[model samples]
Target: MGFKAALSKVFAWYVNRHLNTVRQNAVALQQKTFSNLIHDAKNTAFGTDHHFDKINSYEDFKKHVPVRDYEELRPYIERVVNGEADVMWPGKPAYLAKTSGTTSGVKYIPISKESMPEHIKAARNALLSYIHETGKADFVDGKMIFLQGSPVLAEKHGVQTGRLSGIVAHHVPGYLQKNRLPSYQTNCIDDWEEKVDAIVKETATQDLRLISGIPPWCQMYFDRLSVVSGGKKIKDIFPNFKLYVHGGVNYEPYRARMEESIGFKIDSIETYPASEGFIAFQDSQKEKGLLLMVDAGIFYEFIPSDEYFNDNPTRINLKDVELGKNYALIMNTNAGLWGYSLGDTVKFVSKNPYKIVVSGRIKHYISAFGEHVIGEEVEQALMGVAAEEGVEVIEFTVAPQVAPTTGELPYHEWFVEFGKEPKDPAAFALKVDKALQQKNIYYFDLIEGNILQPLIVRSLKKDTFINYMRSQGKLGGQNKVPRLSNDRKIADELKEFIV
Candidate 1:
């Protein structure tokens, strides 16, 4: 066998052996993880305050530590930012990952030295699992273009801080760094437009085999590569291109356009990593959901979505979760975040292997008129229409049209950027409305009762999202168009670029 194939065989064997053990002992592993976490942090102020010394089991841990969102933990994080040691963890965190906030301002999530190893290990395990499942690792011997955020970090209170992708860029393995495209100089450029240009120029002639990024920005890069190489698809430019490592956002909406840009199909591995921690990754090709990272330095809890907004919600650990329930994720991690709400909702698809599909952000849904529509429902409805119409949705955002000043009744306004223009716009909108009505009983009831008007689909002009992102100065790297909003803030702004 060739060198690449031989290497892949060996790597695959190792990954499978380890993963088998994990799958077989998922429950036991989670229990052990919780025990270890409690032991590790027993001396920290947070642990001591919660009586970690007396906590002996999952029930004890939950009873002592109530669920807390970012706002609740902000004060402790602020103290950490001000250079306090052992305030949260054993010592001050080495780095902070700055995540953009919707309700609150910026969130500086701690990345303790102890947590960094787990972060790196989880990411590697994700790739290794993919290789083990697919047996396609020839790309390892070729170049990879990780279209990440700028690696230039700024200091806050003597602690390094930047975007999560930027933080990860600093720790790219030495061997992979050699194979990674877009020179460090290019990656360090702060301007998105200039950095993309530099990346396109530097890697146009290289032996690229793998590309990794959030799909929207990667679509932009692929489009640029096509333009720079005389309208050639990515496959033509790099015949060895094989895999796509995507995370941070749902890949469904961007899939069609991204494949068109590449002019061929490629295997994709989805990952679930937030500023809080690396939570899960796709470990099986047979499944759609990501396998929960039971062994990672994070203990997980779940509060049902229905109960989450209640005055006092019920919290359940891994052993208590049932398949198919929508739950808001709570995590206590090695980085010293205890009972922290990650703000994302997920539904378990498998119990044996503990896999979940991210449903939506807790705050990013349209609930006007009491018809709650989440990200997963919106994505499915839109993609359904696209499938039936044989068109592709490039990007989209939805907002409630509550209390219109004009005589028109209230409804949901959809601003869609299309990769392939539909043959009939009116029909497309009708089909989308029908699909949504099918998925959400409350939305259907509202429509039937005439309490809510039909959904409106506005065709946004090409590059409308790009222009919008540029206006907000978040055109690249982990930033995305928020799928749903409560007010007309996004709708009014996006209307300026309607086709």
Candidate 2:
């Protein structure tokens, strides 16, 4: 076998070895991982304050470190930014990933030296897991394009600050750099449009095998490639393209359009990597969820989604999570984040493998008029409608349109940007409305009781979502249009570009 093939085989063996250990006894492996975490950082300031040395069990640790979001951990992160050693982790953070989450805007998440290993290892293992499960490793010898953020980083106090993708780009191993497209200089372009133009010029002729990015941004790149290549599908330019790795947004809505741009159906791997850490990735083709990284230097916890807004919420560990229940994720990682609320929700799909599917964001759901709908539900509904109507939905977002006058019931307003507009726009809207009613009982009840007016669909001009994202200065990386919002914050802004 060739050297690349041998390397692929060895990488697969290594990741699968750990995969088998976790599958054998996930709880035991998690317990051991947690033990190492507390013991390793016990001397750190945050660890000492929490008496990590005295913490001998999960119960002991949970009682001492209360659950907190980025806002709650901001003080410690600020201290780390100000050159404080052993603040959260044992030493100063190597970089701070600056993210503007839908709810928690502008968070500086620390990535410590100790945590960097887990981050890099989890990412490598994600690709390795796909190779192991599918027995496809030829991609190793071909070019791979990671549509990531600007690689140019800035300093915040003594710590480097940039988008997570840019920070990760800096650490791309030397060997893989040979196969990676869009040179570091092109990636350093701060303006997204300019970056995409440069990327297309640099990589349009490469023999690309792997492509990875958020669904919307990837769609943008694919569309541009089609336009630049004289209406040629992506597969025509890069026939070796085999795998599309996606995360940060649900791929369902963009699936048809993406496949159309590529000219063929290709294999896909989904991952759930947040700025805080690399969380999970799809491990099996037969299964539909991502395997939790049981030993990735992170101890996990879950709060039932229903109870998440409660004054006092119950936090359950990995062993206690039930199948098919939405739970907001809380994690204690080696990076010194203890019981940190990741602000995302997920549902356990397999106990034996500890696999889960990301459900939605904590604050990205719509609960207006007692109709609670999440990203998964909205995405499913949109996909169902689009499939039935023979339409291709590029992107969409939903918001409540509260009645301006008395005796008028509130209703849902949908902003749809269509790749292939349905033959009948009115009928398309009706189908979408019916799909939601079928998926959500509360929504059905509200419509039946006249508590909500019929759902309204407003078709948007081409490039509406893109323009909106540009206006917000979040045109690339992990930023995405929130699928559902309680209010019209996003909807109001998107109105300017509406058709």
Candidate 3:
């Protein structure tokens, strides 16, 4: 190892030791975090309205503050947006994270100054933990790229506002400023394609070592690199490329195709970051799940996924959570979002250290006929079969076909874009369907009882998903195609590009 890598190890060692201490004292740390957050925001408008100065204990807080999604909480958030002080946090938020919302258009999540540092620290600590575990820190010296949205910000109600990735771009630590890539001008280009071209022009021959982004965009970059370099694999272009850090989407569907683009495998770390706060990250290459952040400014609550829609769902803390049960993640952050629903569901894989695997979005599912198939189940089933059959899945989504055009029984319709289409498409469909049935008992019963026919795979042309997103004017910058939907909104649009 070089001097820089050696030095990183010493620093990583201390951070890892601290993380271990936090992990071991998870319950105590969370209680302290909760107390600190409540105490800090007690004077804010939200706190005052919710009776923050009232009685003690989680029960008292829960009684005072009912759980709220962005819509339910928007009354106070709107006050903040109108330049009101102490509406959510103690003062106005440092920045407002703009995101698309289903019920309410253009949701703005508050990020207080105190909360912002935790976002930076959790991400940095994830890397440090990796270096400590693997003793691989040489990539720190090489050029790194984070394929993201433009860093340009717009003033919104007296606060800077932009995509979270873009906001983070402006805050890249001084040490990494030199190593981070695609110049500010290139990053600021509003058009994704134009920006990508500029990035490829600048970094095609650089010592690019670490790449970070959502999986789909990174795949697009690799494909662009291949075309520009006369079909050369990404590995050939940046020989020192060592690590891939990704979040915002499950990597299983994109993993095989990504490796093919690279011409080999490379190490990857998965993170669970959201607009509210940085939640968790893969702390060890050997672990199957991301290590949930315990000491971060966010105090967490979990509602059983199956019970989420119930009028009064059960809410519990990390101390009471059980393994393998899916829970809708809730957050009460220093950002001043109180009892806020994150809309994502995650399941615990390990206790003490608290490792969690994101299961699926609470709203993203197929239950048209009572078979509540989730993202995790569908991905596992399709990828399981695809892996065994030597098929490489590019992208896919599932929706229930309640009424078949063929006048047959209703079935699930799968709109898929394939990197490698199976030789026997009929057989491939059967395998994927059977695999899914095995995973979901409800689905199995529906198929066995003739309530639904086997799923139909409608293989789509290349750029099918891209075309759909572009048609909606959501082609890039953290926009993702839903894996499955209760309605036919996405599947109907995808029909335009079907092969």
Best candidate, lDDT: 3
In model 3, which runs have C-alpha deviations exceeding 4 angstroms?
none
Candidate 3, 326-388: lDDT as tens digits: 999999999889999989999999996899999999889888988888999999999999999
**Which of the two, 1 or 2, has more TM-score?**
1
lDDT, model 1: 0.88
Off by over 4 Å in 1: 1-5
Per-residue C-alpha lDDT of model 2 across residues 150-202, encoded as one tens digit per residue: 87889987889998988888888887998998888888888888888888999
TM-score of each: 0.97, 0.96, 0.98
Task: Summarize candidate 1's per-residue lDDT along 1-499 as a digit string, tens digits.
Answer: 3576577678778877988898888889888989888998899888889899999988898889988888999988899988888877888898999988877678899998978877787788888887777777788888999998888899988899998888988888776787888888999988888889899999999999989899989988988888989999899999999899999889988888888888887789899988889999898777879989888888899999878889888988888899888899999998999999988999999987889999998888889888888899999999977987899899999999888788888989999998888898888888888889998899999999999888988998889999999999888988888999988888999987888
Instruction: List clash counts for every candidate, in order.
Output: 0, 0, 0
Best candidate according to TM-score: 3
Question: What ranges in model 2 sit over 4 Å off?
Answer: 405-407
Q: Is 1 or 3 the stronger prediction by TM-score? A: 3
Ranking by lDDT: 3, 1, 2
- Model 1 / residue 202 / CA error / Å: 0.2
Q: After superposition, how far is residue 157 of candidate 2 from its true place, in Å?
A: 3.5
- Write the number of the candidate with greater TM-score, choosing between 2 and 3: 3
